[model samples]
Target: MVFSKKRSFTMLAALLMVSLLLSACSGSKTDSSTAAETDKASDSKTLTIMAETSSHADAFKSIIPDFEEKYGVKVNVVEMPYDQYQQHLKLKFISDQAEFDLAYVPIGWVPEFQLADYITPIATEQAKLDELELDDFPGIDNAYFGADKQLYFLPYMNETHGILYRTDLFEDAAEKKAFQDKYGYELQPPQTMQQYKDIAEFFTRPDENLYGVTLMGENSILSGFGFYNRLFNYGGDLYDSNYKQQFNNEAGLNALNDFKELFQYASPAAKQYGWSDASSEFLQGRSAMAEMATTVAQMAQDPNQSTIVGKVGFTAIPANDANTSDIKRFYLPYGFVMTKNSDNQEAAFQWLEFATSQEMMEKAAPVGNIPARTSALTGKLASEYSFYKPHADIMNSFRLETLPLIPEGSTITGEILPNAVVKYMFGERSAEDALKEAATEFDELMKSRGY
Candidate 1:
């Protein structure tokens, strides 16, 4: 499942938001009605889950039969593209036509869903909580547990944003020697912003129709995600601790300028790229590297969808080592949540428990679904799945955060800041002016929402 431009975590014009799941082989566009082939067993109850198209759909297929057999529930995952899914769900709720018992929600949407009273907390006994093995998820309490001590969301899939590069190119003798001779250092994955640009410039070759990196510049939200990720990389934030606008300053300016500079080494078509487009450019061997989700990085090893299998490597995105936060990872927790209108909350919670169980996650990992469980992400499974170890290490050791889980979070995400960055990149406005204007818009939005 390549990313969409619509939702933030769709790992979306993904900055400031996201909702993506496994990579290109996911057949993420499959019809909901056919997602699961339910048995025609007598006296079986049916539960419908509103979800985005994902390889998780494929992973879930393998577990549905077992869950159905044990629970006597026939599950139907009603799927849609991430770009349209958010508005679709909002309309569903507004019209009271939200018939699904459960939904796969982008964590960024949690606040809006909460403020709108659209979902119910997953109320359960201590025994059930213990059975869920909640401790297996590192960020669960901060992300989904409410002040009232009720669980509000269940994360089935989660990810970190990082760099994906061509290992064969990095490891090539001729290339490494040339790079070292030219740059005066070992040719390796970048640890700082300068190294990233340096590596990109070295690999860029227009005559060969290749470039240093593939980037997302089209689709405001998608581009916004790209810009924001850069902003995050430089110890910049959309807002400061007091919730004041702060991305117009030094670090933000650096993030914006650095984002524009990368375009110089990307394909001219880079200006029109989104996550999926950039992903394809990297996967098809058109570029040396790409900044994408850990989930997307897994596809680099899939023989069916990648040309660089056994020749790809993933790592944390580049940051200025001297000036950055310990949180090198971008948080994209796309998972399932129980809907308030559901008449089958208990059964839905049961599904959430069974689906996120350690057993099921380990089963799902091989199919490209990154498990949220601690055990599933380490030891044996981590060894088998190349993407898991880096992601697991980041999750366990680092502090991660997403966009403001506020009712107004959606309005701030997707385009406002990214569009501004693009205007500056196009020479239509000065960087200072563009950021100042965007920051003004951000502050106005917060005020209008009574934040």
Candidate 2:
């Protein structure tokens, strides 16, 4: 769908932040020591960078020839799956024998990497710092900083969530009129939770071979967090300010109940669905709507992948209150960092800067990944790329929120929260009972870790 007024503000804020950062970069000069070091780069130095196996990996690989040609250095690019990457990185760092100079890491893993001393903190050298202004990459800078506020890693890409709907199903004037008449409101995309539910219910006709919604509901850590997104937006959070888990409270109960209620209108196989299953359902036209990442927007519109190519529309996650003018959304950053135990610190820093550079992001944009740099959001790369517009539009529409900045966040959300949600969703226990138990377990876990 077309971007709304709310999205315009988001775009402005992102652009303003980028402008401020670029101005700072222009004013700062590299220190002479760094300039001398950069000048002395010998052809013998070989830089190795570890990257995740994603759609963007090839785009990253595509730039190595240019990098090597310009710097007169040989580069080795290694790709690993997400699950094994962490273990391999830990072993390499603990033994102080890492083969790679740099590696890609999720922002959520920054704290763990920092505590394990797996990443080297960026040098304080004026020239090196000047090369890529921290201000330009505020999200990454914030993620890299420790509790005491020191920079450790750099961000390469930023990701967010949005809604995907079928325009063709609701395109007929008579059908639209009928929907509005039945629902007592226009049949447009929902702006609030009530509206979201209303729309889902309206589209649901299980016996007629159509379902209202499809979700990533397979029993996993992701399912729990996905449930939390809805719970928190409805004014409930997993924990209170005092570190007590509060999902058993009124807000949490209502949130869980609302989700459980929605399942009646979903596909029978939804319980088995993950990202692949949900996307396939939406693309194949078995479902009317899906809550998904920006990365999936184009896939839903592809003729080869979908039966409804020209009929897809987009919007941010529905709000809980229709009248609320501002909708807050979450932004997730994916990027790279240097381990503290690296044998070649200088090479790591150079490679880190190279991977996160605006120039490199611009080169990588054509391969279906969004760049973290603000400058990469518009112009030739955006216009030339097929899926850029929908993702950019969604990003521009919502205020970005991040997960709570706590050390035990992974364990608490990954292991503890999912068990509690499943019990509640399946009616094994009341929301109150499940959440109360989850809170106690989570608090104990955190306490044992000295949180």
For residues 359-428, what per-residue lDDT tens digits would candidate 2 score against the true structure? Answer: 8878766555677777776656765544456556555655555555565776777668787777877778
What lDDT score goes with residue 193 in model 1? Answer: 77
Report clashes for each candidate as comma-separated counts: 15, 10
- lDDT string for model 1 (128-224, tens) is 7787888888678745645565777877777787778888999999999999999999899888878988999999998997899888888466677
- TM-score, every prediction: 0.88, 0.81
Alpha carbon lDDT of each predicted model:
0.77, 0.70
Q: Any runs in candidate 1 off by more than 4 Å, and if so which?
A: 1-44, 145-149, 322-328, 396-398
Please give the range of 10 consecutive residues that has the lowest summed lDDT in model 2. Answer: 27-36
- Model 1 residue 81 CA deviation in Å: 0.9
